[model samples]
Structure formats: structure tokens, C-alpha cells
Target: MINVNQITHHFVLGKKGNKTIVPVLKNISFQVNQGEIVTIVGRSGSGKSTLLNLISGFIHPTEGEIIIQDKKVSEFNETEFADFRLQHMGFIFQNFQLIPSMTAFQNIELPLILKGMSENARRKTTADMLKKVGLEDFGEHYPSELSGGQQQRVSIARALVLEPPLILADEPTGSLDSETEQDLLQFIRELNRDLGVTFLIITHDDEVARIGDRTIALADGKIVESGVFA
Candidate 1:
């Protein structure tokens, strides 16, 4: 589970010598329960991605506390955050962030490689994940050789291969067509249901938000609305 309390973030933008503070998130607070799918919906500049970044430990909040599984991570330095992310969080991006030169199998295997998992273990795990994502036959193909949906499948497989407890997806469906988007969302839902992996997804799409167990609406860096959809 993840808990964010009274978090605020801002950045300095301007010349090197002269900078102006631009706020991104304003007193944002939320909690994600175990085995639940929570969506943060917002338009551009609404700070949805900033909130996700804060949660994922990509960037710490300027002020406030971020507690994951009972540990306060808001004060963690970059090195600590990097270790935490590898151990606890899986990330999916709108761009599918796959390595261009790696084949599907290799791409999915990268995390395990980084973790120093045994070659045999990585092979078995990566192959099983490929099958789980319905990419069993395409592991040998490079990203350039696959369709958009297939490439995203590879990306999803990579994200899940490590079996991290939490997945932080940012605009996961932005690059897909409507049909593919639905399929991908349904796959995510099934993954949540079957694996009990908690998900916190950030997106601007209402349809995407509707797929979650609960939706938190954000605007102007604040939570405007939040509720579980029946």
C-alpha cells in the first residue's frame, strides 16, 4: 500500500541566475490500498504525472510525506530511491520505453539482468512472462518488427517480469488505438485481479480512468474529486 500526505512540489524555471518558482502539486493527499487499482485523472498540467513521479520515487516531493508499505520514502536520496524503485515498483510509460536494439526477450530480461538474477532463472521468468502477455512467439523479434500493440505487450511483460508488488503506469493507453486500448486495459485489470498487484495509473482519458476501482480527479495541482465508482 502507498500513502501520500500533504505533498507539494515545485520547480525553478528561468535563467540560471534568475529563477521563478512554478508549483506542480499543491497539498496532494491520497492512499492506495493493496490489490486495488486507483486512477488519477487530469488534463495537461494537472500534476497527475507529478503525483505518479512522487509516488514512484522518480522525484521526491518538495514538502510532505510519502510512505510505501509503512516506510517513509519522501526523504530518500536518489540512490535510495533507485533501489526502492527496483525492488518495489514497476513502471509503464506512454512511449513503451523499450530498448530499440534489444529483442523482446532481451528487453524483458533487462531488469533481472540488473538485479543479477541467474541466467537460467532470468530465461525461465522472461519466457513465462512472454507467454503470460501472449507474446510467446514474438520474443525473438525486435521492437521495430512488432506492431504498436505487440510492442506495448513487450513493455508490459518487461514491467511485470520482476513481480513487483506495485505498478505505476503513466498514460499507458495513450499510444494505442481505441480497440487496442480496451484490450490492454482489460489485460491490466486481469493482472490486478489474478496477481493482486496494486496499480496507480495516471491518465487524462475518462475511459481509462473508468477502468479503475476508484478514480481521483485532479486539477490545478489539487484533488478536485475522488470516489470509488460503483
Candidate 2:
């Protein structure tokens, strides 16, 4: 469903004349098939996050092309990518990334609202999402009012409310306790199994990596290994 073809990314440090180019990702190529959970695992400074950002269109790749669902997204400008993202991609971040002032219901409904869905339709969709995430009763609660697990569930609901085909998650279980991490992983599996949603997850934990159908390991900005998880 997604392809990263020979992409290279670097950061220019210092002023123009004295700038030093520090490469973050070098010659990275991979593919994520529809309905598969592919996890990218790497240590700090491995450029895993950079790869995710590039794929998410938060940042353009310095080189190479990114095709998603057959669209050459790498060539899209910010406005185009923003619209495409809302219609095709979902995101789950480690910190939940919820608006503390907005109630869970409002947070989940935001995407639908942005899509210009009628209030009645958005309300129904958001409510259904909250139920799917097991947060039906917590809909009125704000981010600060919920536990870490509950907040993450709300984040998942918000991401899935639009029913995007692909979900890109960065360190999804990073902030949770072991039990909560396992719970969230199982929930992710369920979402993939029941909804046929494809996942591309970035994680450093082995336990987290084990849940993937395949794992790609990166080191020094290169893919050192890619294989089915044993």
C-alpha cells in the first residue's frame, strides 16, 4: 500500500557557508502491503522518526519518491498533502497528542468536522468510534481527566474516526505500563484483523516489535534487516 524508494534525507546544520550536512536516512527502501502490520525498529538516531515524518508528509524527502495507494505523494505540496492525509492516512503518536481543552468526543469528532460532515453524521460516527475504543462513557472527559491508557484509546478513536486505510503510529506504547502496553498492542491487532487497516509502526521495544507481521531494523540510517518476526 506504501512504497519508499531509495529515499535519502539529511539536515543542514550551521549557517549557509559553514553548513555541515548530517544525513538522517540513507538509501532507505521498503514496502508496506495492504492489511499488514509492519514495524520499524531502531535505536536512537536511527532515522526511524524521520522516515515516518517523510511518509506522513509532515516533511518532504530530500530525495526519492513516496507512493501511497498508487499516488505519487512525494510530489505533493503542503496543501495537497494535508487534504490527502485527512482522506487517506491516520496517525497515532506516543504522547496521545490530544487537545487538553477538548473533550474526548470533540477530539474524535474534529476530523469529521474538518471533512465537512454534517453535525448529526459526525456525532454518530464519533460516538461509534468511542464505543469501538471502549471509551463510550469517557466521551465527555477531557484529556487530563483520563488515564494514560484511556487517553491513548481516545487518540486511537480520533485516528480511526475517518476510517483511513493506513495508520502510522510512532512509539504507540511508549508511555504506557507493561500491562497497558500489551492491552494497546492487542487492541491494535484487533483493529487490523477486524477492520483490515494497514499499520506501519515505529518502535524500539522488542515486545512491541513482536506484534508485527514483519519487522524492519535500521542502523546508522540504513535498513540492516527486514524479515518476518520470529
Candidate 3:
């Protein structure tokens, strides 16, 4: 479903005035199959999130190519990249970046809404997703009115409502209590099971990585270990 080949990334590290081009990732390569959950586990500054961004087309790598469905995304122009992402990708941020002004249903519907899906289709899609994520009754509430876990569920609902082939979640359970985190993690697993949504989740928690069909551990930006752990 996704291919990353010979990817290397560098960034200016340290204070703005003293930034230096420090190599972070060195020729990393990996693949994610359809309907599988792959977890990236690493310490802080390990470039786990950077790998996700490279695949998402947020930033270009100095040396590598990313292919999705046999098309090289790294070669797309900015306009094409934007359109491709809207059509093929769905992202969940650790911060639950919801629009505070929009109701839960509105936030979940925003993507399809922008994609020109009809109102009836959007309604059916959004309602089904919310129900799947156990947020069917909270559609009219705002983000601020929802608890952290509830808000994250809303985020997940929005991310999946598009029926994107891949879902990239970065530190999805970083903010919740243990029970809530467990619940959210299990919910993610369910999505992978029921919907066959391929997932590449970035997380530091052991429980999070344990849920994956495979786990890859990063150390200083290198994938030191990768194998089937579950």
C-alpha cells in the first residue's frame, strides 16, 4: 500500500542563529501492506514523526522516493500533492487539532464537505463513522465541550470518514489517562480489523506498539529493529 525507498532527511538543529544541517535519517526504507497496523516506536528526536511527514508530502527529502499505489508522490508539484493528500490521506495529530468553532459532526464532515460530496452522502458517512467510534450522540457538541478522549474519538472519526486507504496517527494516545488510552488504542485496532484501514502509527508507549501487526524501533533515526511482535 505504501513504499518508502532510500529516504534520508536532514534538518538544522539547535537555536535559529546556530542552526546546522545535521543528518537525522539515513537511507531508511520500509513498506506497509494493506489492512495491517505498523507501529513506529522510538525515543524522542528519533525522527519517527519525520518519516511520517515524508510520506505525507509535508516536506521533501534530499534523497529518497515515496510511492503510494505505484505513483511516486515525491515527484508531485505542490498543487498535485495537496490534491493527492486530500484524496488519499487522513492524519490524526497528537493534539486532537479540531476546529473549536465547529460541532463534532461538522468537524468530521469537513473533509468530505470540501471534497464536494453531497450533503446526504456526507451525513450518512459522518453519522456512520461517529457511531462506529461511539460518538453518535455527541455530534452537535463542540470540541471544547467534549472530554479529551471524546475529542480524540471525534478526531479519529474525521480521519476515517474519508475512507482513505492509509491513516497516519502521531502519538494518538499521548494525552489520555491509562484507561482512556487503552480504550483508544483498542478502538484503533478495531478499525484496522473491521475496515481494513492500513495504519502506520507513531508512538512511544509500549502498549501502543504492542498492538501492531509489526513493530519497528528507531534509535537515533535508524530502524534498529523491525519484526512481527503480535
Candidate 4:
């Protein structure tokens, strides 16, 4: 589902003449097959998050190509990427990234609204998504009104509302307690198996890594190991 070929990214620090280039990812090459749960694990400063951002099209790769579903997305401009993302990719962030003022129903419906779906269709789709996430009764609650686990479920609902083929999650279980984290991981597995959705997750926790069909480990911006979890 994804192909990261010889991708390299670096940040330029200081003014033009006195600048130093600090590399964040170096020649990272990997592939995520359709319907697989692929996790990327790394320590702090290991560039795992940066790699996710690049694949998500939030930032362009400085060197190589990122091909998703056969499209060379690394070459797309911001507008093109934005449209493509809505149609093909979904995202889940550690912070949930929900609008505090909006109810869970509204948050989940936002993507459908953006896609120009009619209000009736949006309501039905969003309602189904909330049910799928086990948040049917919490639809009227705001982000602040829900527990961490509930909020994360709402976030997952929002991401899946569009039924995008690929979901890119960064630190998905980072803020949850151990039990909640395990629950979320199991939910992710169910989503992958039941819906045939592809997942590329970024995580630092070993427990989280264990849930992956395959894991890629990074250290100092390079892939130190890549293999099946067990």
C-alpha cells in the first residue's frame, strides 16, 4: 500500500551562510502491503514521527519518493496532496486533535461534510461510524466531556468515517493507560481484519509493537531492523 524508496529528510538550521543540515531520516526504504498492520518503532530523536509526517503528506520528502496505492504522492503539491489525503488517507494523532467545541457527532461528520456528502448521508455515515467505535451514546459529548479512551475512539471514528483505504496513526496509544492501550490495539486489529483497512502506525512502546504483523525499528534516523513481530 506504501513504498518509501530511498527517502531522506533533513532540517536546515541557522541562517543561509552559517546553516547546518541535521538529517532526520536517511535512505529509509520500506513497504506496507494492503490490509497489513505495519508498525514503526523508535526511541526519541529516531525520526519515526518525521517519517510518518512525510508519508502523510504534511511535509514533503527532501530526497526520495513515497508511492501510495501506486501514486507518487511525494511529488504532489499542497493542494493536490490535501485533496488526495481526504479521498485516500485517514489520520489518528496522539492528542486526538478534536475541536473542543464540537460534539463527537460533528467531529466525525466533518470529513464527510468536506467531501460534499449530503446532510442525510453524512448523518447516516457518521452515526454508523460512532456505533462501530462503540461511542454511539457519546455522540453528543464534546472532547472535554469524554475520557481519554472515549476521545481516542471518537478520533478513530472520525478517521474511519470516510472509509479511507489507509490510516496513518502517530503514537495512537501514547496517552492511554495500559488497559486502555491494549483495548485500542485490539480495536485496531479488529478494524484491520473486519474492514480490510491498512495501518501504518508509529509507536515507541514494545507492547504496541507486538500487535503489528510486522515491525520496523529505527535508530538515529536509520532502519536498524525490520521483520515480523514474532
Candidate maximizing lDDT: 2
* Per-residue accuracy of model 2 over 1-230 as CA lDDT, tens digit each: 99999999999899978999999999999999999999999999999999999999999999999999999999999999999999999999999999999999999999999999999999999999999989999999999999999999999999999999999999999989999999999999998999999999999999989989999999999999999766
Where model 4 places Cα greater than 4 Å from the true spot, the runs are none
Off by more than 4 A, model 1: none
Clashes of each: 0, 0, 0, 0
Task: Indicate whether candidate 2 or candidate 4 has the larger lDDT.
Answer: 2
- Model 3: per-residue lDDT, tens digit, 83-120? 88888888888999999999999999999988999999
lDDT of 3 at 29: 91
User: What is the C-alpha local distance difference test score of candidate 1?
Assistant: 0.91
Q: Please give, for residues 47-147, the per-residue lDDT of candidate 4 as tens digits.
A: 99999999999998899999999999999999999999999999999999999999999999999999999999999999999999899999999999999
TM per candidate comes to 0.97, 0.98, 0.94, 0.98
Clashing pairs in 2: none
**What are the C-alpha RMSDs, in order, of all predicted structures?**
1.2, 0.8, 1.9, 0.9
Q: What overall lDDT goes with each candidate model?
A: 0.91, 0.95, 0.90, 0.94
Write out the backbone clash pairs for model 4: none
Q: Please give the range of 10 consecutive residues that has the lowest summed lDDT in model 2.
A: 221-230
Give the range where candidate 3 is weakest over 10 consecutive residues by summed lDDT. Answer: 221-230
lDDT ranking, best first: 2, 4, 1, 3
Report how far off residue 163 is in candidate 4 (Å): 0.7
